[model samples]
Target: MTYAEILSHIYALGRFGIKPGLERISRLMAALGDPQKNLPAVHVVGTNGKGSTASFLSSILTTAGYRTGLFTSPHLISFTERIRIDGREISEDSVVHLAQRVMAAAPPDTTFFEMITALAVLYFAEEGVDIAVFEAGMGGSRDATNILDGLLTVITPVALDHVEYLGADVPEIAAEKASICKPGTPLVSARQVSSAGEAIAAKAAGIGATLYRCGSDFDACWKAGKLEYRGVGVTLHEVVPGLHGRYQSCNAATALAAAEVLSGIGFPLERAALVGGVENASWPGRMEMFDGEPRILLDGAHNPAGAEALADALAEIPRGKLVMVIGVMADKDREPLLSALLPLADLVVTVSPALERALPAAELAESCRRQGAAVEIGGSVAGGVERARELAGADGLVVICGSLFTVGEARGHLLSRPFEAFRG
Candidate 1:
């Protein structure tokens, strides 16, 4: 199969929708000769910060001379962006080959995510990666990625997103994420709320998995113009992340702790590699900056907690009048996100991603009106960014955020080459 044909077939599998169970993936992996079982794995699961945390660990391992495979979701520019080894994206030819093989071998009922997860593991094994890190698509217990018995499990702070499938609150959601804690494995986590922490602790203890909490066992904080990470029996000072956002300090700390666990298990990670990796890690579409007269910032702050974090990060930056270009998914909790972001904006341009799940631009405009934030309804992603840039002028700042789908589209427009999603 050619790249286009492969991608078209994979996108068509989206119609099967999100089947939130591991049975199909487990079977699919077995059919692919159980590639996941042949490799060492690290699992990172959370409602937020999963990508950043995984990116950090991947960088650290890659810098330490290990053949590290990083698999993430919701690519910013391309489907090929989701799989990388030693920071190099999976080749288009490889994607075509893998997709064709999976298509031929997998069940017809396999969902998009399940097929992709199996493909990632198969590719990682074929590429002979020393280790791999997987970010779950949803709740860990049933998510396709959970089929791997990862040596180290990192859970970033659990929050209330994906409420319908993961449950309606933080604690319930944490329970589903905590299910990734295999017996006797080390589970490292960010400092979560009381309820979330309690659930994770209980699950870890019940299964005899050692639980390492950020605030309690290890910590990372951005303070006084520097990032300070103290974890894994080492302290990093004056660390600078390649990614933008003050919230990244916590993610860096989580990665450091996870790397330390891997080192403890006989994977040698040098102190110098740890320092350099944390400072050099980059994840796109999370506070990504594009330089110009009117600066562009793209962030996928799709949930209320993420929006609040984005707001705090924005407050810390020195920029002129903030103009926002926004779009959101229909099932998201919109009120809190609008409350968190709109007030920080001088002008808001509302748009919709080219996805069936996206909320209408006019509807989002009404929500912004309720929040007392001035907004313009831009029915197209490219049109919305243009309008926001016009509103921002030359000296003002334009922030594009809300959904990953929205950021992906806006990024394509600004960069002059969009990622081909299912719609494209």
Candidate 2:
């Protein structure tokens, strides 16, 4: 199949729509010879920061001279962004070939995520990667990526998102995510709410996995104007993270701890690699910036916790009036999301991505109005961003956010890039 045709097939699989089980994926992987078995990997799971942590860990492993594969989701612009080796996205031709191979072995009940996850593992094994880093699509235990036997599991701050599918609150969500902690595996976790921490601790203890808490076992912070990281027996100063936002410091610290664990477990990772990796790691659509008049910041902060982080980051940057282009999905907690950013925005240009799941522009605008925000309906993601830039002017700032789909559309618009046909 050609690239477009294969992408269509992959997207068509979405009709299965998030079946919450491992049986289908297991059957598909078994049909494809179980390529995920024994692959040295680091599995990253959380409500937020999963991509950033996986990016940092992948870069660190790559910097240490290991051929690394990274599998992430919700591509910002192109489908190729979902799979990468050594920081390079999989080529279009490779994607087409791999999609074909994966589809052939896929079960009739296979979901889009399962097929994609299978393709990633198959590609990594075929390419002979020394290690791979996978970001869980959702809860860890039944996530498609959970098929891999990762040497370490990293849980970045769990929060209340995916409630219907995962659970109702922090403890329930944390337990679902923490289920990725395999027996005897080293599980590194970021600082969490007490409930979340306790849930994760219980899971680790129950499974006999050694738990490493961020504050108790290691930490990262700006001390006397320098970034410092204290890991499990390894201390590094001047640990600069390539990503923006204060929340990223915690994510980086978690990755650093995981790296330290990998090093101890015969990965041969060194200080130089650890420093270089965090310094160079990059995750797009999360506090990503584009230069020009009225510089634009792109962040996919669909949840309240993520919105709060974006708001905090915006507070630190010096700018004139803040014009925000916001688009969120229909199922998200819109009130809490808007509450975090509405007060900070001088103007909110509401838009909807070209997606079936997106909340309509009028609905989003109504929500913004209810919050007493200065809101206007911009119809589409591109229109909203363009309108926001005009409102922001050269001296002001424009932030595009609310969902990855929104960021992806704005990014594609600003860069004049074509998007892939598939999105899930």
Choose the strongest candidate by lDDT.
2
Compute the lDDT of residue 31 as modeled in candidate 2: 90
209-258: candidate 1 lDDT, tens digit per residue: 99888997889887786888888688888888887788888898889999
Q: Per-residue lDDT tens digits of candidate 2, residues 10-101? A: 88888888877789889998998988885888899997788899999999999999999999988999989999999999998999888888
Q: What's the TM-score of every candidate structure?
A: 0.95, 0.96
Please give me the total number of clashing residue pairs in predicted model 1.
0
Top of the candidates by TM-score: 2
Cα-lDDT of candidate 2: 0.89
Which regions of candidate 1 fall more than 4 Å away from where they truly are? 163-168, 422-424
Task: Give residue 205's error in model 2 in angstroms.
Answer: 1.6
